[model samples]
Target: MLLTLVLLAAVLAISYLLFVSYYPSFGGDVPEALQTKYASSENYKNGAFINQKDVPEDLGFWETLKIARKFFFTKVPNGVPAENIAVQHLDSIQIADYEGESRLVWFGHSAFLLQTKGKNILIDPMFGEVPAPHPMLGGKRFSKELPIEVEKLPKIDAVIISHDHYDHLDYESILKLKDKVGHFYMPLAVGVHLKAWGVEEGRITELDWWQQATLGDLEFICTPAQHFSGRKLNNRQSTLWSSWVIRSASESIFFSGDSGYGPHFKEIGEKYGPFEFAMMECGQYNESWPDIHMFPEETVQAGVDVRAKAVMPIHWGAFKLALHSWTDPIERAKKKAEALNIPLVAPKIGQAIEINSLLKPNSLWWENL
Candidate 1:
């Protein structure tokens, strides 16, 4: 009986591996040419990208098995929002109706739009129904409606993707927004996937950590983020992950594009701050996977570390990607921000943060659900 079960497990594992290998939604791997081109980079060695600080790639096989047992066997009821999330859906056609030098509209999760100085820039616009390869497998988007459909968006000046995770670099969303966007920016070698997705090579710019690119008067600095990347099994870390520092003539913004607690925040603060606004990652965290995602308190600390005068909490209130209560992220971060006296903003989905004015106040609105 034991031998039969061992054989069955081996077959199932191999079958699952083959399934993902053939899945088109998983996205294309880094091409050999790009990999060779980036071979000299410090982050790219042995044909894969490496994190600056040492961290385990994943829980070892035994620990993973243990977690899998708990995850699959135990029911986690608090993993989802109690109701359809209340969001301030915006009409993109009426963007001129609002007034501000710089405007931001978050579309839940990490997707947001930043319109500044006559430019419409999008960040990690994963507007798909799920963060996984397929909606059927990954569940559904929490909010029934988003700020604006991709077709309704104005001509995008540029689109910046933090990394190629399914939750960040969505396939369908990319397809819809690709033509409307003038340029696409991503971490090193991530263009391999975009190029395959039909985005022209000329329209995409790939950057390593600390690299800078200019779009008209705006300067985009690719800063480091304590994160990892891969779309499929064999391609782990072939592409780099990064935060971004966007600076225009009069204002600068720091976007913590999915990162964990790290000294890099302080380094970035000393180098480019004090920023007018900072978007800090504050959700989808677990104690076992401490190195990749930051808890709420850490998110507030990260804002202070970045010397952000005003902070906006992101990466939550959109999806049930973690086991915590849906509102836990905002609630916990709000408490920490109050204790630290850091200015924190929690704008509803599709609500604009007029960076020109005083930062918006936290409403603790999720409790209403």
Candidate 2:
């Protein structure tokens, strides 16, 4: 019996090592040179990056297991739409031929295409069917289609990544998008994954918090967020996570990339307030982990904190990452925004939004689903 158990343990160990070694989606290691550069940042600890304020690691082993079991085995009412969410189709010609004011097209969740100053930029473009590194580990996306397929996208001016999470920084999406994208702007240490995925070093730019980069007439600023990052189990907090501000001479926009409610919004607002529009994270939150993702009410408050002229609730429509009903985020957010007198723009999954215009998409589109 002892020898039999020993053989079983050896087999399992070999399987684990082989999986991590051969799986390209697990991503690459951060080199010592990059580690030396990251060590200078205030947010970087002994080796990994950390949140502005630490998230309490208070969930005990059994409690965590219970939550995981509930998440995987329990079914929450309306956790997914009864029907597949509809998406407005776009062709490559439409994307390539735009000569208008700055605008955005929502691809649901945290993915967007921003066209401004004759340049097209993609933000957190996770175009895969599942957000997990392996399909068996997660469910399929709520929507079957995107505004346009990644292969059909036009020449991209730049790509902005918020962090190294599987939902935000997809390996397959990057491989498909790298050739079309001229440059990439990301938080510190995120470039290592891109480099590992065969993206050229010259095309990638890594910035610490408060750092800024420019493309043509647009200014991209990397700002702080109350979140953590990692693509695999062992690499948590190994790369910086952040929010972003994209400013042009005429208008500015903010994207709260998977952040918890914190003072950073007000700080960002003070530093770059009066934004034309902002997309706030409004989904996949629970009381079990309050410091990582924002509740819907907190989402609206973050919008107000940023002093945005109008706000759009994102991070809810594409996937079911939380226990609440999928529509709960938008419903709660709308109520709070109404109470606060904030203009809430709730566009459909693939709707195109004109950022410069006062006319916003505020229809209750999710109700139809």
Candidate 3:
């Protein structure tokens, strides 16, 4: 019996290794030459990327067991919407021919199509049904239909990626977008995944935190975020994670790409403020791991720290990634923003808001769901 059990364990271990190795969704690794190039980055450590502040990457064994027990046993009411979320559809012709002032349309989660200075740019465009590599491994998107299908998108000027996480940098979405997108911009080492996935090296540009690049009249700045990154078990922190600052002659916006509340917000505000608008991450948080994702109150504070004229709560109203109620993030964010006397724009998915125009407060659309 002992020998049989050992053999079973060996087979299972080998199978797991082969599964991750053969999976195309697990993504590619940075080559040795790229690693040597990244070694000079202050954020790149002995081998992998490190945050400005030391953030814990893994939970302790006992804590892991405790969380797993709760995750499997403890049920939270309204953790997901009762029915498929409603989407306000977009017109492909309008998007393809837009020559207006800067505008943005949110595609539910952290994805956005920003039309600035006559250029269409996608930020963290994860348009997959499930954020996971496989549909069987994750829940379906809250909405049955996207605002616009990936095939219907116009020619993209660029795509800004914040990290290499499966939720933010989706493999299937990238495959659909590569042909339409002219360029890809991401943090250091992220280009390896794009290259592996068939994007030309000449079309990809990678930058470290605090680095800036220009595309026409717009400036793209890779800024700091208090987060760790990995798509597979062994690749944790192999690629850097960051927020982004996009500025044109008349409009400036900030995207908090999955970050915890940190001093970096203040630093970014000092360097790039006062932003006309900001998209703040405010979802999938737990008290157990407070250092990587922000609570709703922290989300509001981060916006204030960044000196945004107005703020929009993102990273929620789509997938259910945590134990909180589906509406908890937007609800808490509204309350905090009210207390702080800041304008909070919670537009319905696919609604376009002009950047130069006044951002009026949105109606309570999620309350009825």
C-alpha RMSD for every candidate: 2.1, 1.7, 1.4
Question: Which candidate achieves the best TM-score against the true structure?
Answer: 3
**Model 3 error, position 13 (Å):** 1.8
- Candidate 1 ranges with C-alpha deviation above 4 Å: 1-18, 96-99
Each model's lDDT comes to: 0.85, 0.90, 0.91
Q: Tell me the TM-score of each prediction against the true structure.
A: 0.94, 0.96, 0.97
Query: Which order, best to worst by TM-score?
Result: 3, 2, 1
lDDT computed for candidate 3: 0.91
Q: What tens-digit string does per-residue lDDT give for candidate 3 at 147-171? A: 9999999999999999998789999
| Candidate 1: worst-modelled 10 consecutive residues by lDDT | 92-101
- State the RMSD for candidate 3: 1.4
Native RMSD of candidate 2 (Å): 1.7
Q: In model 3, which runs have C-alpha deviations exceeding 4 angstroms?
A: 60-62, 358-361
Question: Candidate 2 — which pairs collide?
Answer: none
Deviation (Å) of 125 in candidate 1: 0.3
Off by over 4 Å in 2: 1-10, 56-63, 358-362
Q: How close is candidate 3 to the true structure, as a TM-score?
A: 0.97
